[model samples]
Target: MSDLAILKRRHALLGEKAPLFYEEPVHIVRGEGVWLYGPNDEKYLDGYNNVPTVGHCHPHVVDALAKQAGKLNVHTRYLNEEILNYGERLTATMDDSLSRAFFVCTGSEANELAIRIARCATGGMGIIGSDATYHGNTSTVMELATNRKMGGPKRKKSNVRSVPFPQMYRAPKGMSEGALAQAYAAEIQAAIDDFEKRGIKFAGMLVCPIFANEGLPDVPLGYFELMQQIVHGAGGVIIFDEVQSGFGRTGSMWGYENTGIVPDIVTMGKPMGNGHPLAGVVCRPELGDAFHAESTYFNTFGGNPVSCAVGNAVLDVLEQEQLVEQAAEVSAYLRSGLDLLKNDFDLIGDIRNNGMFFAVELVKNRKKKKASKKKPLRIVNMMKEKGVLISSIGADRNILKIRPPLPFTTDHADIVLEKLTECLIEVEG
Candidate 1:
């Protein structure tokens, strides 16, 4: 079918608001390694998807998934050794305190479970999230979604509070990094205090440790440490939503490892099963026990045998191929290349990265640090025209988000860099 016909059918069946990439979306039919193929055999370098973290259609993950599906596929209630073994191996990568796991089919469900655990353990309804961030789509978790684009609650829920995410690029003039960290941490404390004043008990703060949705900002130093103390002192848990920053995307196994603070509960998604629907929450034993005691939680397809096999296989690929270390090395190379581009392009404002994930902020005026909202989307579409795929993020949607599969190498980075340089020149002209 033609693109227009497909689009018409999509709009009619799935509603007009369903999101698609670029002004003209690609009709991707096949994906392998770091590339996606269209119907005419035209291939585009995949540079924006973390869902296939180990690379799309990796033989290892696909084989494991197929083999397990052929043998058995059952929910968590069944006696399943695959689930137990996978769970044990997965949590072993985390801090000792985070030794328990709860499986779910999507990030939304994982985050919902994390919120439930926090509220159950702390006896509170108050939760804190970043002012420009998205956690999930579930009605309960959507209350924490303050991103206007996500269509969160029209009115701010009294139980939910948002704090300005810390970003060094836009720090108030003359404020030291140390002071900025304290000021950001104070925002959390203020939220907690307000919750108390409003007679709402404090539950916890949930955010991506790397602040991926907040333009991957260079966070202020000592911010999370102070936030940790403030939250714990207020008798609340710390929940790190690692849906975008987990499974070696951040060089470390978990996003929380990069931050000084150790989250009480960590939620992971997307990359866990390498395109399979697998996501879960890892928390302290006490929190898991408390949540389970209070409510019986069960998911039909979460941690099914096939999902566990795929999850285990993804870990196998990560370890055998050493993708985590490769991410660190390739990201360093990409960072240096991006620095060279920054010198050549006046549109470049700030570049921030965590391992393989990168965000390049565009600016109309570097001196004033004005966000170039239109240029980012235009550049993204232009890069798509050049056989490369990327996207835009941030509250103003002026930050280029370049996050590809784990198999993406220095060579792939070079292609992205080359295409990006050309696009910037055209956009500037």
Candidate 2:
């Protein structure tokens, strides 16, 4: 058999009954600043992945990981200065109320831990989330992340409800932005009412400041404030899942900072260790106290010394390089480029962005518009063929998710725009 055929057969055997997102996937062998290289050493511009917040294999992060591993890679049981120092640095960037930190290895675990803390702090069973907002893959968070239809089975007794995402692209007609914000906030209030009707108290609301996986739905201004009031009045905590949008990816220290609301608990990851396995949940001291009193939560490798050291180094690099500011500046440039492209291409329906995080929605028809999932899949694959890497997302997988590392530059933006323009033209034709 041919090499390709053998590889395909092996894949089928490994996933005997599993469903895959793509029929054919590229074999990436290495990555660096804003680029991924295939097994054949072909360079692909990375316009989608954000887990490498700073850049793939950043020198500072690599060095820190190596140094810590050589010195001591112990767990939380042993008192370590690296964990303490990293926690202090991370919490310093958060709101004053969020003065405590609990480390985890991935965004999913961080969010799971955050939900546990929220439930304990409020002593409530009901939880709420925005429609199409992805928190994590764990059972509790999966229950809260009900935007996607494929997100597992519904929780029969888990008092989790979903509110409509505050998407300006599909907002109600004739509604002002402020009015739309209020309307979206009302959805949460309605959820609270439903909870009360069911004799269930409100636990908390989980939100993604930019709604990463659902589409880069920028939360309308004042929306966070209104929702905060509603959740707080209903005796529920607020959790911001900044997993994909944190660590300067949104051009700020944190995504919630752009929303101008201070959440009771904020879970962050992906970029915490610049591609290293590290994540954390920072919460209000009161919530942390409640969580501690409720249960002794610990992970074997959550706050290991190596992860802490790498995380600390990531923070240093972010500050010294001013990558957050770079994201802000380059985001404006990239958005403008996308806007110009939208004018040239009718299929490009919406351009939504926050900092370096952005998405371009591909639509089938401008008039009875609907997401063109097939078109995006084709475009993503075509772009990959053209030496650019991007991904498709949204409820229908029609939105092109454009999130690169903070180190992405104007030159990189130009390359992405050029390749995307070509892909759109070919697809449109």
* CA lDDT, every model vs. true structure: 0.93, 0.86
Model 2 TM-score (2 dp): 0.96
lDDT of 2: 0.86
Error of 2 at 132 (Å): 1.1
TM accuracy, model 1: 0.99
- Runs of candidate 1 with Cα error greater than 4 angstroms are 154-157
State the RMSD for candidate 2.
Answer: 1.9
The residue-by-residue lDDT of candidate 1 on 1-429, one tens digit each, is: 999999999999999889988999889999999999999999999999999999999999999998999999988886869988999999999999999999999999999999999999999999999988888899888987776667666534468899999989999999999999999999999999898988899999999999998889999999999989999999999999999999999998888888987899999999998889999999999999999889999999999999999999999999999999999999999999999999999999999899999999999999999999799999999999999999999989999999999898999999999999999999888
- lDDT of candidate 2 over 151-268, digit per residue (tens): 7446445588888888788776788889999999999999899888888988999888778877887667889899999999999999999998888988888988888788899998
Worst 10-residue lDDT window for candidate 2 reads 15-24
lDDT of 1 at 259: 92
What is the lDDT for 157 in model 2?
56
Candidate 1 structure lDDT: 0.93
